[model samples]
Target: MTRRHFRLLIPVFLVAILGGVVWFQLRSPSAETIAAWVDQAEIALSNQQWKESERLAQLIADSGDREAAQLIAGETAYFEGNLESAFQTLGQIPLESRWRPRASLLAGYAAFRLQQPYLAEQLLTEAIESYPKEVDAFRVLSVIHYDQGNLRVAIEDLQQVATLAPEDARPWRQLGLIHRDFERFPEAEQAYAQAVQRKLPPVLEAEVRQEWADVLVRLARHPEAEAILDAIPPEVPMTAERMTTALAIAQVTQSPEQLDAQLAQAVKQFPRHAPILRANGVRALQRNDPESAVKWLKTATQVDPYDYRNYYELAQAYQRANNATAAKEAESEVKRLQALLTRLTELSEAAMDQPWDAAVRRELATLCRSLGKMELAKQWEIAASRCEQAR
Candidate 1:
């Protein structure tokens, strides 16, 4: 600790301090210039002037206004479906910047679009925790939580989002989803009803109506729900869809042979709708004439192997009828469709408490073993593992 050494260290310490200060100063944006550009770019985006917004973002990006530029660029790139690039670009924003929240939020969404679930989670969590007021983070977080089969967490995440955007129809839609996942049939019905009442866009409103009807059927309140739908005649005369709903109600209520009679009428009217045909197959399942159901649904699978419900019901029918050969075949188709549905439901957690998912998996495993397909049974055992995790 000589005086000479101390004096020499002071210069180095000052240099280090000065360099740190300069680095921080350099990191901050030119607020006036960035703000002007941000305003202009926002107007451009609102007016659908993508070209102008893109140009401004690129111009600022080149000038080292990294945070602002990255935010705008990510938004524009998302518009164009260049999600990977948008995620990478937006993720580069310095952590402490004011625009960092927005950048992280955008990056999370871009990562989701690019199918990078873990990355989406990390980025979105940071954005949400840093800016709890931002609804965008909650929206993305809800999906992430749902995909992991944590429906409770998903519900909590979406609740915050609903509070943040009470007027938004999306919140009500998400609320319906939470209720459905938990098998809270009555709550789901009300949530979807609210979504419909919110003056949503027509297409979305129609979808809400369908969802409401589904929850009603689950609650065994079929007649009331169908009456509600019947009151609102479809914009395009969707008698076919209404028929399918009616058939669904009959199936749920066990209104003896009602579905059978409806099927004949359905075939006479909207004979082409696969859903109606599938309903007929389901009615056959209820009749204890599994062989007839198997015979009919076999044709159904041939016509549409991708409809998992039909295939699953058909497999159940074959099993009930003690036709090991046909049951195993139908079940193989069920597995393929289940795998596809799992992939599609990645964000929506399509597997979580989905009524038929676990039943189908368990039956598939059982059928494989009964049919002497030991290896297939083992594969289905693995599928059962996945189904448990989803719950």
Candidate 2:
């Protein structure tokens, strides 16, 4: 199979989700609005009588009281997973009065859910500006920035959410991750520690601790990170995530023997995992045993070529072994990965971040030259330029 494509999503570890949402409830209750609409709709909506509610909502929308019945219908449609209709319907309500803040916030999130990033940003920013106390609007804006790879800005925006609602753990967790990526270890440690203090369960605490370990590893405090890893019984849940942490530490520290031991332990526990097998190849690669590494990486591709990076690693192994022919075959598969890295590079420049994407492309382009494929180098350069243009 030809592996000549280049792309990458955020790495699983680095890509953190903002899980806990702290929605702001206005001190002025909706009880007054609900009272106004009681005759047309009801005190509460029943899922079974959706059509009744929709009809009543249309009447309320016609009456122009901002009663929120129509908004309820739209939100219901969204909750039911009728995404397109929900977006279309939600956009029509004129939320110019008291409900404007809530309406704009929901509309922003709906646009985001509909995959219209620009509209989402516009609507969410409007909501937050109109009602600076509306915490959810900042959360949604944080998402828009995060998807565009503006992690520092994303963290900045999420921090606004915490400032608006200081008791929320979600923002702290998110801030912790962004800080970790930026190598602000003390800040990351403190943010994550605050998240832990918020009484996140033992299960999630372990996950957060694993994140802490990653930050510690980057800071070259492997021993402290390892202590966190050692606290959990190996028999508990999140074994794969735990193993991934161990592997990262060993790989980063160039402890091939330690890596080998971790892989061996993981294999005994879960022999069939493709990642475990791939980790073995990585361990061998670290030790400068290219041929030996290929023995495992090839198996990894055979099991799952869709991963893309496995083939890239396999190509690296071939190059290291000095088997140029085999290396060329593997190198051919890197185009897609190259394209992806090139795009990431462009996005980074546009966001005024580091030029990691460009650096990655140059590295890949250099490899193409090594394989005597200058056309590939030019293609990558063009891709890089396109990214820069987008930036």
Candidate 3:
């Protein structure tokens, strides 16, 4: 109540205000400090220190660096395999922002992993334009081209990737797979050899060797195939593909009695592998045992309904067993699947090139629906709408 007491209170109030101001200033980092934190976050991300990056993301967000927070969060989502979240977060970054190129690159990969190839191609193209030396974008683009059945363009993309990263064996291994799938045996062999020369990890080396052996078997280089198989360590597990390749070589090199034992062992080891069951069906058919062939082939079809070859073999087995109705049904499936594959290949090529073509996307959606790829069908339907809007 006294005037002196009032004056003392006034000074205390002013000091309290000054102290509050000082605390606020200390808590709120400067723009430059926020930028430095963003840089540190980026470094943590590049080094794959995910927890550190996440910590920085929270710090950056607290400091009002929303875009930098989004970048870190997007990358974390991507590494965590939350692809849609990654794409959404990364895609929200402004195109003109300095961080956009990195965002686009990661978002592009997320789109590709989500099977939105058209969107992936668009974002990857933008990323490539901004950062021409980025090898991962080119590698993913190559796979997209391969999915389109544009093998030449895919090869070109891979060649660019190889030029950018010569020590990476993955491109050579991928090239081998493509050639093997297309039945270009000699090219597959050469690519596999190149991959081997690059000194792959033990597991990958064994896989590559098995594939190379399969290619050799296709080329009738039985001795070489056998040698390649022999080179694989006994400790490695026998995968279905490896088992199939061994069987192929056995059929060529072993006596009938030995092959019978091999087939029985393969079936025992990989009881549910469709290729092994199909092999058994083919062997039974060769021996004129239609009932056994029908049993094995039917199982193969059940195991892998998408493989047309199973149905094709089943049709033969059914026909030989005098099951005309079942034979016709299997044959019909073969024809349907074959036609679906042909049309899908064509439309995929078209869609890859004409990303704005709503008609192509709709057709793809319909095809996917018929093939029981319901998830892919839904994606294609959504993409079709985007295509229409883009147009």
Candidate 4:
């Protein structure tokens, strides 16, 4: 070969060698290097540096660190609201791996977030069986059952959690909520009392106290309810809800003149409040002042047009006043509203099977408007609107 040709070949050979070195550096990292990367990713996650953590986690996964990589990737996807990806990623973790139980728990959570309660139940049950000590998995399984309308099963799951973690106030609180939902006031009161005895955050403690007071009122133990309400610290301002509870206590415990004074104060404080207005209307009816009842109830219907109870009360007032025409009209409205509520409930159940259906959401909004659930109606309307916009 000529000298000039040889020089050119040497330069090309050197370039190839450099390219090979670069490729080697970019290949799958060693086990030690991947472990170090995993540590860095965990630190980034702890610091809430999500983007850096995601990048590092992806790098580790690509380097063949499947167990830690999939776990971190799934968790990152969950935090980022990528539910399907999170579920799929976490499901890839082998059952033999130490991370499997946690992966199953997270995957179940992702399924629940996706509104697949049945799948969540399945996954969570498996996780519970695999790691009987996982309190969080049991808790989430209970919530899934509750959301699916399996109240009995939900209660049973919570009982298991209580047995497993007796010191945890959350299980007791959940039991109280379930009892309250079923209107088992005595059971609710007992559960809430137990929860109150345990360690709880201040806000949660206040909520439990309020709910317990409500149960006391239901049992007609007015003095007990009042004591519970009075114990709430001054730092927790008397919200409209607390005011309503206070009014209930006064209604049961106070004399006529004192009740009137309390009602007047409530009206002055919460002018235009629907519950207070409804209370006044009911009181007028009980006093046999049909004319006054009609007047107050009419105003309430105007202020909160969707409450079926107000229409029913208005009908009774009209009947008492011998206004047959007005009574018939109000009664008809009550029946119509009741029928609409029933239809909406059926639609809501059906929609649960097809949660992304915009038509169902729109129908729900219409029904909610007729049932005095105005805020929920607005939410349904917004969801329908978003679906339409996406389309």
Residue-wise C-alpha lDDT for candidate 4, range 171-201, written one tens digit per residue:
8998998798677999999999889888987
Per TM-score, the best of the predicted structures is 4
Choose the strongest candidate by lDDT: 3
User: What's the CA error at residue 273 for candidate 4, in Å?
Assistant: 1.9
Candidate order (lDDT): 3, 4, 1, 2
How much is 158 displaced in model 3, in angstroms? 1.1
Every candidate's lDDT? 0.73, 0.68, 0.87, 0.80
Show the lowest summed lDDT stretch of 10 residues, model 4.
Answer: 382-391
Residue-level lDDT tens digits of model 3 in 220-240: 999899999899889888798
True-vs-predicted CA distance for residue 108, candidate 3, Å? 9.1
Question: Which portions of model 4 show Cα errors greater than 4 Å?
Answer: 1-89, 94-102, 109-120, 142-153, 161-171, 199-204, 286-288, 340-366, 374-391
Better of 2 and 4 by lDDT: 4
Write candidate 1's Cα lDDT for 65-178 as tens digits.
667777787677766778887777777778988888778887888877765656777788888877889887788878766654556777788788878987777878878977
State the displacement of the C-alpha of residue 134, model 4, in Å, after optimal TM-score superposition.
Answer: 1.4
- Provide the clash count, candidate 1: 0
Tell me model 3's lDDT, rounded to 2 decimals.
0.87
Q: Please, what is the TM-score per model?
A: 0.54, 0.54, 0.62, 0.66
